[model samples]
Target chain A: MSTGLIFAGTGAILFAMGVAGVMLLAHLLRRILAFNLMGSGAFLILIGLAQRAGLVDPVPQAMVLTGIVVSVAATALALALTRRLHKLTGAYTLPATRDD
Target chain B: MTEFFDPLAWLILLPLFWASGAFLLGPTRGARLAIVGVAAQLWLAIDLAVKVGDGGTAIRHAVGGWGAPLGIDLIADGLAAAMLLLTHMVALPLLLYARGYFAADASVARYFWPLSGFLLAGLNALFLAADLFNLYVTLEIVGLAAVGLVAAGGNATQIAAGLRYLFATLIGSGMYLLGVALIYGAYGTVSIATLTPLINASAASAVWIAAALMLLGLMLKTALFPFHYWLPPAHGGAPAPVSALLSALVVKASFYLILRLWLGPFAPLTGTIAWLPALLGSAAILWGSWQAIRAVRLKMLVAYSTIAQLGYLFLIFPLLGPDGLALQAGGMQVVAHGLAKAAMFAAAGAMIHVTGRDAVADVAGVASRMPVSLFAFALAGVTLMGLPPSGGFLAKWLLIDAALTQGQWWLVAVIIAGGLLAAIYVFRVLRQAFLVPAQGERRHLSHRAPPLLEWTAFTLAAASVLLGLRGVDLLRLLAVGSGP
Candidate 1:
């Protein structure tokens, strides 16, 4: 396979791994890390696709750039929330038994 | 460029300008400036509405004077302009209410106004963005600002709720990015309009997977049914105005994107995707209503109600397919639910402030003590119940009619059942607040609330009721892109 296709396939596999990690993992922090991996994989795939197409489209690349910023913001906020929740009720895991 | 003359341009800039000024003002001044900022935004929103009505459509500047497929485009068709109007109008009152509520908390002041401005800018920009990637940027601005606002409370429960909200949104945005990337790989473009014509290959695994991933991501962010675990606690725990904004507009922003894409660029994909949204929406309605009925606290109950009410918006998808009564009803339900639910959350916020209690039973005698707020709550409840002279009622009526017209009996059953369940819970709060309070020993409010807070709630509730009468106008606003 060409380098571009290899990178795209690798990114896709990483994206799937991230989704699976989130689904299977019990730890919130790990799940967060999985989410980051998923996002990074997506960025890689976008760049790989642009390269394969033989042109750099600013649109998708810019979107990935913006997504990185948002992911960090969301992660920081989640971490802060995690710290606060631990302080309040002393429970770390999400309460899986939803009444509804 | 004369494109700057587009009123939509100001709608975008007004909030950004406010964010800049709010940051410079800092904390104490920021709060006042935030209120002023929302007021100005509200006015601009109104102006945009009028201009759209006259012109039939609205589109503003291209970022660098390049057209679509090159540089970004920011356009506000009737649907977007209406959303913008609703958002700013809701923000205006909530900010005023927040001014009074957050007056004493000094530390949070630094982040509140600027973050709120950022949130508003994100919301407006998201509504106007003409490209998928541009929409992504706007989503981040909103996500960060909102998470900041949630954690600003700095309590353990608030923080936990914020964290859950963050995880869900992050995973959601991640899924969204992946989908966008896949579409770009296949189609070589990211503008939604450009992707519209490229939506072929229905049997293709990559295409279906991308669509599914995107839908799931949006569903999680929108807090539809099974994915809604994070919503109730976080919204219930946040400061009242923040809760109101989150419930009223923020969640709706993501849903609006789902709507924009589903109806606009992804129109062809609807045949495959419509069933899932409709199914998830049904589940959300039943499950959400069940939770609302059993909720202990008034705020949590309202939060659950939001989950159910949001589901009502999804019912439009299956009905929106063909041009028929079902399609019209589905479209009308969107605006109806938006107005009614926002009113409900604002009213719930006001109640919490006046009574200083979160429990439903403790709401006793609130009607007698705070007549205006209570009246507002009841009016909002009427809307929720789909009773006459309320937008909620009209939306439901249209939805039910559409369900019947489309022969979707299950949806009809769910809609009616959900409406009945809604009435039960709404009355539960109403009876506890107004009548039960009379039977019990009357308790005085421990604190006096500022008049502005009460008025803000009352006006929002009144607007919801007024929306029922003015359904024609609101529906017209939504008509910019899709016709009834």
Candidate 2:
């Protein structure tokens, strides 16, 4: 019933949804979004579960900050790659494996 | 703070320092700096290994004078030092080879130096990290840097492969972060030294879940079969030197984390699940070798062969016992595979460079024109096939001995079968190289490979074979500070 528990529950749900989205979705942009959602969910769990006992912990908070920065870098890299792929192939999804 | 003199710190800082310097100096100027930086790293690695070997314990340095539980720590045990030594040894020659390989392409070289520097920095940091959160951060650094290197080629296939690689790496690290969070929530500490005694077989369900999550994440990153779909394209599609780095060193970084965890904090939880990785490893050997045998492209064959070689590293997990034979086998496999794979990829790059083609069919009669590269490839193939007087052979000998002592008959069978399967793929490439081209088909002599490229590849391949003769020293080093 505590707030921290509630946040943790929502995080678990978000993580599941994100994983499913990543697996089922083929569009590159949507996959990136799904990846972000997964990051957010993990961050939420990190903060929420640390505070589940009603004690404030700065360690997980610090970790979440670091995680956010890393996620942003990854997101930017993914987006840049997606942009280049789109420009070259004119497709949002990856093409099927070609016979070389 | 006196630990500032520690070589472990320099093993990491030297790479970052040169990486930044290289980025500022531009593409054509970084090669010398990178070579010098890696050479310094090699010396430092040797120094740390000697220290650890003589001291009979791990060297621990707490950053900023803050000890574990409140601050980060770096520990260089025998395993870490061995890996560091291998990293620098492999990287030094590869840097030289890359200088020749990328001589004509400034655009790729521009990013290649900084990215590879960052990659090496991340790898050293990952090896020395003594905590879960630190490991996660280092993993991200290594992953992102690798993806950037893959994408540096700036073509459709390379970019697409890079993107897929980026997604897989992100997911892998994301899952690892979740595991770290769960561990923190359960134990309030992330330091490996502190958590070692706290995590037991009877720990709470959260600890179990965390172990599963962490193991799965690392497995994905290591490209242990079934999760290997992202690896071949990323490794195969990149430029030659880039492919060499990715296949030879990058994947092994994640596998090192897995081995570290299994030996340290997760030791108690590994009893029931020890067979899982080995089972998957057996599958990888069979599947990966089959794929390599069927691969059309030369680099793809080498890349797929990397997957098969990596599977051998996992086979030791099931045979782990008090004698530490399996551990020695794992270490030997890692170093041997690293040296041979680097040589193989570098040689493949040279062949492709000369022929201006990537297909296996295009390499016909390359032996007559490029004897040095072909000899390098065949020597590396000798190691890959686990022939006598090669490090691969010694590693397999130890692994089979361990399995026999443990009475694990199936593992013995898998090891032998894997070796035979490896022979098929290796000879397939060699056979193609020795064959004459079809009549009237003109040989495409697109470009000549520099002597530097051929010599570097040969050096690495020769080192791999030489290790089999002098492997006792490495085994002695591996024995330091390795126990409960």
Candidate 3:
């Protein structure tokens, strides 16, 4: 396959894997990791598409870069709060049930 | 070059400028500043509306002075301007309500105000954004601010819920970005205006794939039907005002984007696949209503009602054709629901904060104790149930009319049934408030909650009633600059 097709296929695989990981992973942090994985795959597809068009537009690149930073920031904050929850309860907490 | 002042920029900058001021002054000073900020922004929103009303359609500030596809652009169509006005108006009362509401810590006062301003800024930016990528960035800013607000509660459940919300939002954003990439690759540009002219049946496979991915991503973000798993916990679990904002305005912003895409870039492709959202919408209406009916917590019931109401939004898709009457109904539903539901959530917050309980059974004798709050809640419920002289009634009237006119009476049936379901849940609260229970003595409360919060809820609920009167003008605005 051509490089564009190869990259697109790889992106699709990564997307699938990320989705499956989100479903399979029991831990909140792992699910977050899966989310990032899906995000990276999306970026990869965008990059692959840019390369396919044969002109490296700075716009999509800039957007993806911004996306990466945002994902990291959100993940960091989520991780911090999750850690706090674990510390508080001595158990890895999910969402509160209706019983609460 | 400058015939008139570009009013759209004010829509964006007013809140942003205020946010910076709020940040500079710190939280206590910032809280005071937020009041002024929201007021100023509301004034600017009014100004934009007036200009748009007179000029027919407001389009200004071509990014870098270039046209579509070549550079970014900002256009304030009637729908956008109206939404801007609504958001600013809502934000004004909400900021007033926020003042002194959080007495737990001074840090909360600080963190919350700046984030609210930022949220306003991001919302304004999202409404006015012309390009997909630009919309994505603005959404991120909005999303992060929202997550911060969710986490600001400083409780374990709240934090855990915020984390879940954060993860879901991140995934949605990522998916949206991927869709943008696909569109950019296919069309060689990401501008909505540019794509509107270019997108057609002959468009590349990538375009169709992009549309699907984008819709899927948005559906997840908007919490439509099967994807609505994220909404109840997040909206129900957040603090009262935060829940109010999330249910009222934040989710509406993304839904607005979906409407934009449907009307703009994806108009031609509707007949081929428009059934998708309609089908999903039917499910949402039924499923959301079912869930709401069963929810024990007041907030959860309202949250699920939001999911069901969103279904009404999607019903417009299959109905809009040459005359586009159905599309107009959808627009009205957007405004009506936004007003009514926001009012309901805010009133619920006020009630919960007062009584310290969310269970329906626990709210006995609240109506006598907090008459204004209870009255506000009932008034908002009137709109939700599609009672007369309310925006919800007008919207449903339009929708049912369209359904009958098109011979698609099933949608009409769904709407009627959904409204009935809404009445069931709403009356559940009302009955609990009004009916005297056996156990409790009448306790007259000393500390009446802030008058501003009560006024805010009443004003919002009243707006839903008012929207019915002004529906004609808003509908006219929605029609501007868009071809049937």
Candidate 4:
């Protein structure tokens, strides 16, 4: 397989693992990390698929940079929210979905 | 590209400019600037609509003089213009209401103006975006801004709700980006106009996966049925103005993206999967309304009702035809729900402000105590119930007409049944409001709501009802630049 396909395949595995972590994990901080992993996986796939033929494409590279910025903002916000929740309620996981 | 005056770019940049200006100006002075800014946006939106309607073509703009396939493009058609107008119309009154609502609480207002500014800017850019990657960025802007607004309450419940909303929105946008990546890999282009013909020419597996990923992500964001768990808490727990903005506009933004993609590049692949959204929509109508009826809190009821109402927007997917009747019906539903839901949430906010409580049962004496707000709530309920002289009535009428024409009797049944269920939940609140409180149950009013707050809610509710009479013009506008 081409280098691009190989990297995309790995990215797909990472994405699956990230999704599983997000869904099955109870810890909010871990969930945030998993979310980042999911984002990174998608970014990898974006760049990998574009370079499947070994020709460096600037478009997906540019998109990956933009994606990373958005990911950072999202992560920071998530961390802030998690910290606030912990400060206020002293809990790491969300309350039961049916608690309301 | 710079030669001609472009209202599209201004519609976006104006909000971002005012948002920053508001941030630096502080809460009190910033609010006035926000009002002025939104008023200008309303005018620009109206002008764009008139221009698109009169010209009968979509207006397209390439950023920095770089054409598509290499740079971003923005396009505004009748459908987009209508949404822009709707956003501003709802926003103008809500801003007025928010100013009065948050007058005493500077903390919430401090972030509300700038965040809402970012939200409106993101919405405008999303509506005008002609490329998939650009849409993803706009989605993130809207998602983050909305999450910040929800968390602005800073209470434990609100913060937790915000965190849940944050995760949900992040997942939604992440999936959407993956879909965009796949589309890019498959077609080597992200522009909608360029990809439409190309996608129609091929039925590759990658295209199908991209469509599925994008649809699912948008569904989660729109809070359609099964994925709706995160919505009620985030929308219900936030301050009233935040809830109004979220329920009325934010969800509709993602729904619009779904419709845009379905009608554009994914048109050919949509036939086989058309029934999926409609099926889920039927479930949402039944399930969400039932939950709304059971909700103990007033805001939660309105929030749950939002889920039910959003289901109607998806019903048109299955009924789409060459005549565009389903499209018109969906547009009408979106506008009607947008106005009525905003009014309902605003009225509920007024009631909560006066009563200083959030429970449905606590509104026992609201009818006599705050007649204007109670009347506003009832008037909005009229629209939700799909009663006469309301936009909801006209939208349902058109939807049923289209369904009957297509021989989809089941959809007709779901539509009618959904309206009936809506009436139950709406009346549940009204009945409580009109009830006479027992001797010991009477609660003193915590504070009198500002007349601005009550009147703004009333005006929006009245406008939603009045839309029934003038829907033809909107329908005509919806037809501009669309296929026959």
Model 2 C-alpha lDDT per residue in residues A35-76, reported as the tens digit of each score: 999989998988988994577999899999999999999889
Better of 2 and 4 by DockQ: 4
Sliding window of 10 residues with minimal summed lDDT for model 2 chain B: B438-447
lDDT of 4 by residue, B1-484 (tens): 4535688889999999999999999999999999999999999999999889889899988877787777778899989999999999999999999999999899999999999999999999999999999999999999999999999989998998999898889888888998998899888889888888888635788888889999999999999989999999999999999999999999999999999999999998999889999999999999999999999899999999999999999999989999899999999999999999999999999999988888998888778778899999999999988998899999999999999999999999999999999999988988888875723645654467799999999999999999999999899899997672
Candidates in order: C-alpha RMSD to true structure: 2.6, 1.4, 2.3, 1.4
In model 3, how large is the Cα lDDT of residue A7? 76
Best by DockQ: 4
- TM-score of predicted structure 1, chain A: 0.84
Interface RMSD of each: 2.6, 1.2, 2.1, 1.1
lDDT of 1 by residue, B225-337 (tens): 88988888778878877788888888888888888777766676667557778888889998888889999988889889999988888888888755545444544555556
| Candidate with the greatest lDDT versus the true structure | 4
**CAPRI verdict (incorrect, acceptable, medium, high) for model 3:** medium
What is the DockQ score of candidate 2, to 2 decimals?
0.73
C-alpha lDDT values of all predictions: 0.76, 0.90, 0.80, 0.91
Instruction: Tell me how many clashing residue pairs each candidate has.
Output: 2, 0, 0, 0
DockQ of predictions, in order shown: 0.58, 0.73, 0.58, 0.76
User: What fraction of the native interface does candidate 3 get right in terms of contacts?
Assistant: 0.59
Q: Tell me the tens digit of each residue's lDDT in model 2 across B125-175.
A: 999999999999999999999999999999998898998888888888888
**What is the CAPRI rating of model 2's predicted complex?**
medium
